[model samples]
Target chain A: MSRQLIIKGSLRRARFTLDLDLDVDLSKPLGILGATGAGKTTLLRVIAGLERDFSGRVEFCGEVWHDGDHFDRVPTHQRGLGVVFQDGRLLPGRTVESNLAFAQQRARNVNAAVSYEALTEALDLNHLLSEPAEVLSGGERQRVALARALLARPRLLLLDEPLAANDADHRQQLIGYLAEWLPAEGIPLVYVSHAAHELAQLTRQLIVLERGSVTAQGETHVLLEAQSEAIDSVARPVAAVVMSTDVEHSTATLQLDDDVAEAVLPGERVLLQRELTEDSGLGPALQPQSDENEG
Target chain B: MSGDLQAVWLTALLAATTTLLLVPLASPLAWWLARSTSPSRSVIEAVVAMPLVLPPTVLGFYLLVMLNPESAVGSLWIELTGDSLTFSFSGLVIASIIYSLPFMVQPLQAAFRAVPESVLEAAATLGAPPRDRWLNVVLPMAKRGYLTGCVLTFAHTVGEFGVVLMMGGNIPGETRVLSIAIYEHVETLNYDAAHVLALGLLGFSFLSLWLVYRYAGHRFEVVRG
Candidate 1:
């Protein structure tokens, strides 16, 4: 498909100016990585047509969304863009079945997209059909949210921190879903996130945003290794986790090599198991926390 | 005296009709005022909500002008339906809708606006369009706001008199609503009949508000505001 989104210009809004300009050809799911307040959400809003306070051009599939001269501010609903919020905005008034039904109500060509039954099966949303959206867990909501979006059959799909509100297991589930589904559909996705590590399972093409502009944008592996070096750890490989907790013991366990690596516990000397060399002292001075889930 | 059961039925019918007319239009306009970013958004918002700030007479006067048979608006209406809209049931309905606009909009707007943009963007990325977003995403997420707006509009319209009085004269079985009946009785020193109508309006409004709060509190904290 010839689907791609291009946004360029200085988005000046009061003190918050999203000056970063970008043109991304979405053959694969591209991660828009940034720290908090880095305009990741703003960028997604522009593409989704929810935000318009900027002097620039946003073209999708060679169709102009907003070009200063040819200003076509297509309303969000007509833009054919799908979004998944941190909390799944499933209609609580409707059951999970009705939620999908509501989305299917808006599909321009409903026959072109996957049926709700097929999507429910794809995302494993069968049991939650009768349940009210409010009662669903974070992971369940995320799954249903994905199902809702897929049913809409959008031109561009946008995800803003899909795993931020989710627990580790839920995050893992969504990542697994993304890996299996996004490529199959071949629809372009601009995944916005604060942490790059959460995108580990997905494609690693990165657009590292800082302040309001892109500080770095390239292949995931290159950006990760280069960034880890540029950061506190000088020129070292690193693995990062989105979760942080105070372990009771003086040691931290890292999951690797089909087992847990405790401060004292041992694992295979697989070099790939190591991330960046850093003050985190991953190789030593770390004790394994109990309840370290191993796959 | 509404010692006659027919009057009671008439009043209930009028109140319900008024509520039905106000909810849908008010909800979407309210959401737009509270969330949209068009350059002229505030102008449209201010105009939609002007009834809240303007005197009831001003609104009533303008509406009366539009429906008067000798005027251009009345001429257009005469052309379309061979009748004037003023001092009629539809006119009263129109006046009541305007009077109750803010009541419906404020609650729904507050509710829609309260939804975190982050949550919405997530849904958009997932592939929801405007209709799907509102139905599957906005409305369900803002259930408290929607319910609050509906009940408030219904109750407010039920107890309406001012704008209705200005635009719709006391024409029994046509434009004569319960509030008008209560006012008519009070003006003519018919305290006994007035007492019955006033109490009915009062008790029912209280009960409506109470029921809404009771049900909504089970799902949301209406007071945390």
Candidate 2:
């Protein structure tokens, strides 16, 4: 897959200094995982052209948005990228329909085509179109925000803990929609979150950040396998996908590390320890063919 | 007694004119003061709010000296418009705008401040330019502030006496407004007409403020929520 976004910059601030040299593929969803204050949000801001106090270069699809030598920086609006902030950030004065309309207008201004009607319908927002954004519930607001951003027809989508406000049911439904929608639409997604389960559900590739630095970058499973020695005793759990659920036996089968095992299913994605346990029946004893235990 | 109509009309005219000019002038300044982190922002803010504390006559005196025919600004005004700046309706309008500047700027600044930075960032990321965001997001959210500012500035300008009297004096049909007219009536011992004009102004002010507080107060409640 071709690289869609390349950002190399050094941002100096009083709180922290972030030195980033990141190249992201356009084909797969990239997950940004970091602890609180690890510069995850700052990284998104820099890439989206929101933070311009940095000296470096940002190239998107062969066009350079910023160059340190020339002091050239494109503003966020012209970057053709959609962002969903943690607060939802819906315009309080506008109705839900009007908010979507404004994004549609922007898409048209940029010569990008977006179907607001289809998007609103898909997001189940047709019934709430006339309601003012201030009255929207947290889940409803996030859905509207997501739909509004998608209606802008951005080439890349940047999400900064966008669903943190949503309840579990809503978050799951929205995540399921995104998992299906993003891949089908072929939009490059850069999802940032402190929640392991969120990143696990959404992305195959992971960029693990710590103290304003990238500590690991590779496939999600591989990075988790290497994560323990990479950082001492920070057992960031790896995600296990549920393959099948046997309701009769009250045990679900999980697929992790090329090994199938029995486990209880509380959700589509569940966190699993690298050292397997007997309750899940996913110990190394059950996986003799796997080389993950070698090194 | 016939002059009461002219005073009423002139007061309305002055207030309307000043409000119209001040709205456009104060909007950008208030927005900048709310959002700017430049070191000079505090300086500009202090300057804008100086009129709120300074005696109106002091402000009027400085304006009088500045607008006199011999000063740089006064000479420029003469060369451009071929008229004296002081003792004219134009001079009164200028003094009123300066005197009422804080009434307009403070409210607008507060309203603009209430708009969260995240909303503007979302607007930018959604492809709205600065102007578009202000028009679509900032303007709508701050509507109550605009209304409050305009009403306060108009009411304040209508009730002003010292600045108008010192800078423009009483030139009937030209510089004489309701406040100056009422003062003149009191000075000449025409208590009946004085009481009439004073009561009329009192009633008008009470109504405008009541209406504004009633409507704009609710908007603030909504904003806070």
Candidate 3:
């Protein structure tokens, strides 16, 4: 459908300079993969027109969103965008319902694929609706933020770790929901995450960034497989399958191949390997294939 | 109305007018002071805050020099409205606005600063334009600031004396405010009338400050600059 998002710019920060010149097709939802301080968030900020210091051209779907000059540029609000910041950034001193209402009120008048009731239900936000946004946990806040962004009915969706704060079950559920909803609605998406499995399931094309520059770019699975092999060579890894998840306790029971089951804690790092399953309605199930150097 | 009654009415009118006018005028200036990173921001802030530290007579002296009928702004006002800018109600309104500017701006600045930039960016990405963001997001978050600014401005204008005496010079039913009336009563040794007006002012000041603290929950500092 020729949905092109072109960004040719350089933004300088105190830590590092983010320089990029790329023309990406948004038809296959794009994913930006990078480590911390790798300019993933900065790149998303540039595309959303949040970085006013960015100098160059940003054109989307034949529209000139930015063109180097500070005065002459399409502002972020005018660009028909739905951006979910990493922190959620819900309006303070307001309820979750009010925050959602804020987006719904200003939503573009188009053929919306998802209704308010449906989105709230899908995100499991009916209980948290009356709660003030300030009192929400990180996971609850992200769910509300994701719902709010979808409610905006944006032409382009930019999500920066929209589900990172969520527990494994909710994260998988939302990723599955978005992987389906975005395509059905034909909304071009630019998702940023450091999780390889997330990018594999949600996005088709991937751009890996390192130190504010694109280090690798290709089809999602192909690059991920190559990256996995490279990591496998360095560290001998053990394969494990998630048997059950305790969302309340933020722990997951992983059954290793030798029949040894270990309950992994919340903040533990585990490498997720995508396993293709035909019967699993939710896309590919992310099997926790390895704990780094635990073999 | 009696002389004292007229003075009271005039004082209320002046305070109301100054408060209403300063709300719009100080909003943009305060917003700028809250957000801008320009080198000149401090200079502009200092100028806006001059009335808080400078003696009212010093400000009144400069205002008198600048707004006398012979001065450019005074002559322009005379030409436009057929009235002198000195010893007039209009003159008092202008002087009061300047005298109460810091009262309005400082509270609003602090309030605007309290609003996180991330929230504003979130509002923008939600399809709200600049005006919509300002009205819905900024205004609601800064309501306490508006409350503080309005109460302080109104109370400060009501208590104006030195500036009014120097510039607007106690013209009955024109510029004769409560403070000026009290001064006249004391000068004439009418201690009863002076006592009545003085006590009213003291009560009003205390009440205004109390309202600021009670409702706005602000520290109610006069030396915010």
Winning model by DockQ:
3
Q: Which docking class does model 3 fall in?
A: acceptable
Q: What is the TM-score of chain B alone in each candidate?
A: 0.85, 0.94, 0.96
For residues A60-92, could you state the per-residue lDDT of candidate 1 as single tens digits?
888887876435566666678667776677654
lDDT of 3 by residue, A73-113 (tens): 99999999999999999988788999999988888855787
Query: What are the Cα lDDT values of the candidates?
Result: 0.68, 0.80, 0.86
Arranged by TM-score with the best first, the candidates are: 3, 2, 1
TM-score of chain A of each: 0.76, 0.74, 0.83
Model 2: how many Å of interface RMSD?
4.9
Residues B1-225 of candidate 3 have per-residue lDDT tens digits of 999999999999999999999999999999999999999999999999999999999999999999999999999999999999999999989999999999999999999999999999999999999999999889888988999999999999999999999999988999999999999999999999999999999999999999998988643221100
User: Which lDDT value does model 1 have at B155?
Assistant: 81
What lDDT is obtained when candidate 1 is compared to the true structure?
A: 0.68
Question: What order do you get sorting by DockQ, best first?
Answer: 3, 2, 1
**Error in Å for residue A67 of model 3:** 1.3
List DockQ, one per candidate, in order.
0.22, 0.32, 0.35
Higher-DockQ candidate among 1 and 2? 2
Instruction: Estimate, for each residue in A76-174, the C-alpha lDDT of model 2 and write its tens digit.
Output: 888887898877888887788888887877883344333566677777799999888889987788889899888888888999988776665667787
